[model samples]
Target: MPDQASPAPVSTAIPPHRGGLPDPRHFDPVIFPGAEAGEVWPPTHFNFHAPWMHEAGLGFERDASGGIAVVRSFAHLRLLVDIETAHQLFDLAPGSRDFRLLRLIPAALRCVERIIPGDPMPGPLLDEEEEVPEEHHLYAATTAMVERLAGQAGEEGQALAEAMRRVPPGPGMFEAAVARCITRFGFPMATVAPLARRLQRLANAHARVLATAAAQPDYAAMEKVVLRTRQPLGADRGWVGGGLLTRAMDGLLPQISRPRRASTAILAAAEEAMRRPLPLEAPTRLILEQDGYRDRLLDISVFWRRLSAAWMTVDPDTTDRREIEALARNTLRRLSLTSLYRAPDEP
Candidate 1:
């Protein structure tokens, strides 16, 4: 987390490949192809997902070639690192390229020695039974802690939800409810403050879109609001990345078969209202029909619990403690809270 006035220059040396395949004989084939095993790989690849590894001078090069060589080398690294360790270090799945790469390391290492003449071969291959990496105990422990916190937060949210339902809908009321959740639940302000603000902003946008569509009853106007209000609901946003919200949406939402179809569906009821003289509440009701608010509330609740668990798992005296804290702080900063709330403007 120490500020470097200038970032270290990235190596432009491409990893050596034959027939567009990574040459396993080369040291650090996935990252620095011509360099030795002890040489440092570029830190850029792990900048976001595995910053601890980057700080430790371990990480592959970010390559886009999609060649067999890079893939093979990556597989080798994954096997070398093992699954439980990889998970603790970075978000990786058993079906991931890293996981699948384990099968290729032995062959790759043998080929590497034949090509390089004196390069050290990889250690003996792991048996199939041995290949199954151990569970990430830390994550398991963290999840237990998170569940306890979530139970407490969920009760607070339930209370707020009850109060919220009783009050008539009005401007700033949703924001007030969100503020109350943060205060009553005792969620970390550094993280929850920004997320609550974003939820409020999205609620405001939803409200505005409904109001505008109801008042004007035009497809073009409604479409503009839809486009303007659309927010990124994916893993690219930090903290939310690899979290429950990302999982729920990725698991539940149908794949994009056509451009803007999902967004259109979100506004479909509003579009219908454009042609029919429906009640003022109709468009907003239709928007809620998609369960957007419900999902968001769930996401908010889960995010805090996960973050709290992560905080609980860290030990201040550990070697990577600073890195862990830095990672958490950086992710919180990148939660994109600042961009969420905006003044309503003509679309």
Candidate 2:
């Protein structure tokens, strides 16, 4: 007989105790639909959008047959099953996380769904609105597009659309409308993708510096500096922090009452830094101490604020629209992918 490979050695070891409960984080994959024995569910993309999803006791992975498996962790046990089974369980146990995840599906489907059929927009028309400046034209076009999309979404969409229409036209109104749309119909990725991308870039640029500051023992002092900027300096207050003597001391300090623009920039940088995940490393005290570091933070802060204001106003002429659109698209795509519904059939 041909030589046979030696049998693999098997070692016997006691599994670690998990506080009197089975470790939901690990399980035999054989029992799960389409999963091979001993496989663990791969992390899903949605986890990045909302890290709390994992904390809320839900997980996702693919089985050996390449089918998605939904894993629910509860009371220290994990139940792995097919999507349909998962949905049924969700229906029976409907929690806040379940509803939140469900909301993403309809919102994402709204994007690719062929509601109008044929052309989403018909041939050019000779209308007064067309005569408006390009910025106004694009803004109106995007707004109209959103209305049409919401109209096709049925009762819920219509209600949201109606609420949006009630808001007066302007950046503030648009901001309100966008907020309502997201809360009711999820994000309108097609419209807001550019802005989201810009925010992501801004977030990336400051992540390291912010992480460093966060790790320092005197980080709280930095926060106080950033927070104090929100209040404008006034003559009535003798001293900024305490009394007349302190005010005199502040006047003697060169950096005290820094230019409004500088303060604004720092505030903006702080806000953006708070929005995303930070890297893991020892704090670089030298980086925080450098004048160049402060300058860089200021520059980014100013740029981010302008970008944000433009977004709120829907300034069509702003060069940053591309980044905004990209951001929106990225967020929408992620939400769409991780949603509960299967991919919609291609038309």
Candidate 3:
């Protein structure tokens, strides 16, 4: 009989059932051998799972340091997904938003390997050439690519097609926009933490003030007067202006909030924001600021083959135990691998 080599080691795959409603695991667990254990669920790697299946046909694995790494590097072709697992934590402008925040996803892992050459983070692996947007060519280019993905027949192909349908409305849709940013210009979030935190605190305090303003009788009358101003209805001018005016309308809500019932709504939202804090740059003031870093892993070639197979094997997902625990270790090893990207001009 002809000699046969051992079957290649399988890798970890992001399964179909994305961690649902009440629980959104925004990161991938490194359920591989020798991975780390932490309170962090969904180690951001899984956030780009869709793009992996759709594009590279790969899985997850561990690095030299026993961290999680993607099997195949990201390609510029096919569905470009950017999982924005952290952006919602603040009131970031539509302009400066990072879109890679979802859970159970697979995205371009190259960015994680390319940090600037001299920087502390992973350099060559994450540093891609800067992308200059071609606003005029945007629509035509996006439509063409979206159609290509949508045209596929199988469920996997169809899923990518459907997601492409909901490309997020904006000057540059969400998924593609995220890729362009990270691949071309990676985000530096370590320093962004303090500003994000302070902003969050202010938002909480403002909510409290709003609650107080809501209860006062005089504030109601003042707000009524502002409504009659008959100003133009631009996005901000009308709604937010009215909101601001009403709050300051003799400060009824603020007054009512005395002994302030920071009503459960804002408080809950605030807590959620904190729990899923955006990956803002680590603050310089932080005791040991890990200022900037990439989102994925290095040498995913070894990591993914072992990971995807394992993920496909025992994924029961009971809250008591995530079936993908083995994969978590792979993710942990790469946590220190420095997720950076190669310059677009490289090869």
Q: Each prediction's TM-score against the native?
A: 0.19, 0.15, 0.16
lDDT of 2 by residue, 106-197 (tens): 21221222211112221111000111123332244335433453545344345445655766653344456556656666767554433323
Q: Write the per-residue lDDT of candidate 3 for residues 233-282, one digit (tens) a residue.
A: 11233243444433332233223221112223322333233233232232
Model 2 is weakest, by summed lDDT over 10 consecutive residues, at: 122-131
Name the lDDT value of residue 110 in candidate 2.
Answer: 17
Cα lDDT for residue 90, candidate 3: 26
- Poorly placed runs, candidate 2 (over 4 Å): 1-188, 216-347
In model 1, which runs have C-alpha deviations exceeding 4 angstroms?
A: 1-163, 166-168, 182-188, 217-266, 269-347
Indicate the residue-level lDDT of 223 in model 1. Answer: 28
Q: Give the per-residue Cα lDDT of candidate 2 at 276.
A: 24
**Greater-TM-score candidate between 2 and 3:** 3
Q: Which candidate, 2 or 3, would have the higher lDDT against the true structure?
A: 2
After aligning candidate 1 to the native by TM-score, how far in Å is the CA of 281 from where it should be?
A: 26
Candidate 2 has a TM-score of 0.15
Candidate 3, which ten residues in sequence have the lowest lDDT sum? Answer: 289-298
Pairing residues by index, what is the TM-score of model 1? 0.19
Better of 1 and 3 by TM-score: 1
Residue 262 accuracy (lDDT) in model 1: 23
Root-mean-square deviation of each candidate, in angstroms?
A: 26.9, 27.7, 28.0
- Write down the lDDT that model 1 would get: 0.31
Q: Tell me the whole-model lDDT of each prediction, alpha carbons only.
A: 0.31, 0.32, 0.29
Choose 1 or 3, whichever is better by lDDT: 1
